[model samples]
Target: MKKLYYVVIGLFAFAFIAYLFIKKEPLPTYNVDRYYIEGKENEILAKFLLAKDSSVIELDEGHFLLGQSLILDGVNNVTIRGKGIHKTVLSFKGQNKGAEGIRISNAQNITLENLTVEDAKGDNIKVMDTKGIIIRNVQSSWVGKVSEKNGAYAFYPVLCENVTIDGCISIGASDAGIYVGQSQEVTISNNTVFYNVAGIESENSTNVKIFGNEVYENTGGILVFDLPGLTRYGKNIEVFNNKIYNNNIKNYAPEGSIVGQTPSGTGALVLATENVHFHDNVFTNNKTTSIALSSYLLIYEMGKRDAEEEKSPDELGNGVASADKLNDEFLKDKKYNPYNRKIKIGVNSYSNSRWFPTLNNDFGKLLLFKKPFQTIDILWDGVVSPNTDYTICIDNTKDINFYNADLLNDFKNATTNESLYKCR
Candidate 1:
């Protein structure tokens, strides 16, 4: 019995030493000399409200439940950071005032990093009319069931210049996870976006680069769009070196929204944009189409046809005439261009597991009617300006199939001719 007791004591000592050796060291505490905010929710709110120019506000490592939006307006050189992305969380789950969880307007040289913001009533983080912004190592999400009631955008920078969004994760946005609109000189890199209507979208932006991101499981992976009514038209955009796959999520955007018209299983979409380049991207498991190049006229005409069919099944053929009249009306504004021009697709890889396309929206149904047996790798609407030469160039993509839907002629001369789309 004495020998057994001694052996048991030895075993316990050995186990304790092993545990000590293998245990992880505690994370280093944030010790920078700055304005640190902690304690109750109201205290944090008061500190945020007191922030001024050149303020460095450091959030402590705790979850904060705030009632109103945090606004940083007309400040210069402001930095709002936290202990870590997972350690510091700001939730506006019950936000009653303001549309955005965190709103930065008319600011210059702002930086937001190392935090998580979730469940805002509108946009999680909205930066508008600001210049020189950096959003790094941030995470934004909407928890619970994914629905139209979720916010439209996670990280939204609109009408801003010199913006960079890097190393971020965004999820469950009804419209877009990361959206840069009407901005200039933007870089969005190394982000992970999923479960949104659009994973990443650049609308009416110029000199934009989207690279080094993993985008999957959204309704559409990446979109470069120039809408009709926007003052700015997108140009000089490059999308390269990204992994976009499995973007087959159902469309959850609210009715009448532009993104609500996006079909599921879209890997990349270029719509009414000029001088856009896509290269060195890997696309896999996108069920409907890998890359779709569309004109605003085609999308509008199809939507009109769908609506007409819903209202009066006998009025199917009148959509094209109505769409032409609307396009003419939109052309009254000289800045608006309805055709996609100078789109260069270079050296991208694509693989799909499913052969059949999605039939959830009108675009997908059109694809089904065009090709019943197989899915498309690349699709172009074949809508071009009658006065200008608009080209869709494809290089180093001989293995992937291409289709021209001939929307101008109403699919009377749809073709799979690769020679017509060779790079000029």
Candidate 2:
């Protein structure tokens, strides 16, 4: 009798499981309304001019010419997407007053995707003072050959946080193609940047990871920079898996610009930053040094001698107010450090570079005096404090040339200290 009761209970459990497995799933709900707009210029501008929170603006595939910049400011959770990158185009060919093709500011959770922007009066796409923003599958360009008159930055995001820019193309910016300044927690990956002064630039930003990108045919491929008078220092940055080659494009940046200080054919330039890691990257055919390391004093003495602080009072509160003040109060203040230290270069492949450093300025002449046969794969201006030996490690770099120009003492005596830069 007990065995018979157990068999009945097992049958009942199996039947209940079978009933649960046959239940149906609910269909997806489409409650949010999508507002699609196309055609005549004024009507399209009207819709975007007054964008509200949680707004979704879809632009159809076509050529759009606007006289003014399209702005989506002070909005949250807004999505401005196009049908396709190649299908939809926004042109600022006739723009005379606008500063960008699209400018987004003071927002959160903003997503901009699948659009092509060209011929802007200034930057193609710029986002500032925002958080939780995503810029994906976008193409930004200036319509003609690379020129100084072109915009300074293509995809410019400044003072932002938690931003990710992926699958984008930037071309023909006189400054940096993709410039991220004074931001943090950023990821820039899978982008193609070409024909610009600097392909990708990170200035005074922290916790950035740049990888899986193709950067070529620019003056300098990648620049990790820190200028004075900007809020916060740049640290904890990682750059890997990038194809940086043939960055011999002529320097088209206007005179006195920060990028103009960059030598043509530089693969990567790290200036006045700390804790940067470069790993598993390809560097080839660059006419200059494949990798360059220097302090902010190198370029700061070049030409940007304007004593007048560029940042306003509000912006000063955000970043360092003055370069002089930071230097004066160096030890007392932990917020600013203008020295490039603790850089790790690991497992990178470099070939056919350092051909241009021989022709560079006074420092280049000193490098040529050291070794005339081999081009310098890595060039470090040996500018450091005696008390604190900044750690720069280069590990497992095979068959690559290197130079250390001790510029602090007028480049009189230099050292090939291979033992000092061992992998840590």
Candidate 3:
């Protein structure tokens, strides 16, 4: 019996050791490269800072622990390349000086390809006021558990023109993974984004195209928003042929941020943007709704209103006067449009089983209060401008289940009258 017990204990210990060995991720093999930089972090940073126009900086296959951000300012036609996405890693886990991992400002014709940047204090890659930028085959992420202390954006481009981000992988951002704001002529295609608050976001931009992306497991899949105090308004956007599903991750954005208001289980939320189109995208397993078209008033006024200060349905007459007053006060700038107009949804595939809505924030609670029975596929907060011709046009009404939550009427006359919102 003693001999048998000793054999059993030895076998169990050996099995446990083998399991741990198999579970560990193997490191990539490094090839000898004389031309690539394979030294300390300061050496690599110096090469980037001193790079001239039309120069190329190649990184070797190794992990670099960086403490400060790398800046490429006022340089034109620069290219930064690496051995492979998994081979060359730049980690800012102990970052102490700068906010971003890489910052490119006031440059033109910059290209970054084939690398991984992880765990920055702020955004991983922030390109501002640049023209003709290309980011291809790059990966940006935050390691370990997802938290609000992670970076806000992975690939962030703002106030730029002629931007293209293709074949990139982004993960674990507290805010949007791939974000383009106040930029024109942007194309974001062939990317994979997940485990962020919002996977992909286009805010206050024009002439944008988002296609051929797989976006999943975020708080919200995609967002097209026009905020109150921005330099430009969002318009002329197109989203097609993407796979957006299962975006039910809990929102981890910090308090008082605009994206903190986003509810989990939301697939797409279009807020106060015009001339937007959605076609040929596949939506699946979004627990709350597939698509929601909302006015900024719904988020700013009604969503922000304290729940303790409740008004009876009888006290609010049609709810138009309160809404109008709030709109006038919010849209005082006269340049920002507060209503969604000329939006079209055509031929998009939707597959979502009925599930409970999220109760993390006030907006989700409001959605649950409005429709307590089951989930929704397409929801429109029925708030339109009387001055302009606003319409939510759908091509195939029979295939989609639509709900018009009469937010302006305080849910008094909420209906599924799809014919009333037919394409004109």
lDDT of 1 by residue, 1-424 (tens): 9999999999999688546433442311111122224456776677678989999988888777777898889999999998877678888888898879899999999999999888899999999999999999999888776787888899999999999999999988888999999999999999999888899999999999999999998989999988766667789999999999989877778654667767888999999889999999999988789899998877677656656566333432232123333444466766788788999989999887665676665666677778876788888988875654546888874788788988769888898886777886
Quality of model 1 by C-alpha lDDT: 0.83
What TM-score goes with each of the models? 0.85, 0.82, 0.84
What would the per-residue lDDT of candidate 2 be over residues 66-103, giving only the tens digit for each residue?
77889888999999999877677887877977789899
Pitting candidate 2 against candidate 3, the one with the higher TM-score is: 3
Winning model by lDDT: 1
- Tens digits of per-residue lDDT for model 3 on 191-266? 9999888999999899999999999998899999877666777799999999999898777776446676677778
Better of 1 and 3 by TM-score: 1
Off by over 4 Å in 1: 1-39, 306-332, 387-389
Candidate RMSDs in order = 15.1, 22.2, 11.9
What lDDT score is found at residue 363 in candidate 1? 63
Q: Measured by C-alpha RMSD in angstroms, how accurate is candidate 1? A: 15.1
Of 2 and 3, the candidate ranking higher by lDDT: 3
In TM-score terms, candidate 2 sits at: 0.82
lDDT measured at residue 290 in model 2 versus the true structure, 0 to 100: 87
The candidate with the higher lDDT, 1 or 2, is 1
